[model samples]
Target: MNRTDLTAVVADATGLTTHQAAEAVAATLAGIARGMAEEGSVALPGFGTFERRARAARTGRNPQTGEPIEIAASVAPAFKPAAALRRQVAAGRPAEN
Candidate 1:
């Protein structure tokens, strides 16, 4: 679901107004981003971990021309689900710690 749907769910669950829930969602997203930027990762127990993945500079092929080219180093964001989350998804049932 999108942000609006998530906001609605949060609002209903927490008895918060729509605007408050929306702000909370936005703030949570911002915090995640900030954490990623500053620390390169964030971990939530029973949920998952978000991290940075790095690729080194290297030579790569130009697919169309079959020519070799340089590929710049890069850092990318990634996520790995916790075992609990994976189990929950796989079994379609609540995950037990």
Candidate 2:
């Protein structure tokens, strides 16, 4: 769901004002992103862990030109689901701690 829907759901469930819920959600997301970028990872219990991984530089061929191209190494974000989350998904059930 989009941010608006998420805000509504949170507000309804927590009895908070929509504005407050929206701000809380936004801030939470910002914190997670900032943590991952600054610390290279963040683990959320019963949810998942986000980690930064490096891609090695390599030579690739361009499909259109059929020419070799140099692909620069880069850092990328990766996510590993927590055991609980993985189990929930595997069983097609609602996620729960």
Candidate 3:
């Protein structure tokens, strides 16, 4: 779901107003972004980890013209789900601890 839907869920779950929940969600996302930018990673127990990963420069083909092109190296954000989350998704429900 999108931000609004997520905000609604947060509000319902936490007994907060929609506006408060929205702010909370925005702040949480901003914190995660800042953490990734400054420290290169953030880990949340029982949820997942967000990290910056390096991508090496590589050659690629232009789709439109089939011409060769150089792709510059860059750092990209990535996520790896915790084992609990992975198991929950695999089981199609919350997994028993």
Candidate 4:
């Protein structure tokens, strides 16, 4: 499901209008980003932890030309699902809180 579907679900669950749900969803994502920028990570209980991962510069093979190319170092966002989340996904329903 996409953003619109998610917004609808939020609206149904919270009795909010679709527009309000959309704003909430957007704000939630923005908050995560801001948290990551300032703190390098965000943790949500029973859901997951989002963190920044750093990659070292390295040489990569050019698949088409079979030549080596330099790969730049970078920091990327990563997620590790909480045990509750993993169990919920495995069981096809949310786990008992």
Q: TM-score for each prediction? A: 0.84, 0.87, 0.93, 0.94
Q: Which prediction has more favorable TM-score, 1 or 2? A: 2
How big is the positional error of residue 56 in model 4, measured in Å on the Cα after superposition? Answer: 0.9
Write the number of the candidate with greater TM-score, choosing between 1 and 4: 4
Go through the candidates in order and give each one's C-alpha lDDT.
Answer: 0.92, 0.92, 0.95, 0.94
Could you tell me which residue pairs clash in candidate 2? none
Model 4 regions more than 4 Å off: 95-97
Query: Candidate 3, overall lDDT?
Result: 0.95
Candidate 4 per-residue lDDT, tens place, 4-39, comes to 999998899899999999999999999999998899
Give the worst 10-residue stretch by lDDT in candidate 3.
88-97
Error of 2 at 57 (Å): 0.9
lDDT of 3 by residue, 18-37 (tens): 99999999999999999999
Error at 58, model 2, angstroms = 1.2
On residues 1-97, what C-alpha lDDT tens digit does candidate 1 reach at each position? 7999999988998999999999999999898888998999999988999888899999999999999999999998899999889989999885563
Model 3 scores a TM of: 0.93
Which of the two candidates, 1 or 3, achieves a greater lDDT against the reference?
A: 3
What is the descending lDDT order? 3, 4, 2, 1
Candidate 1: residue 64 Cα off by (Å):
3.4
Q: What does candidate 2 score in Cα RMSD to the true structure?
A: 1.5
Best by TM-score: 4
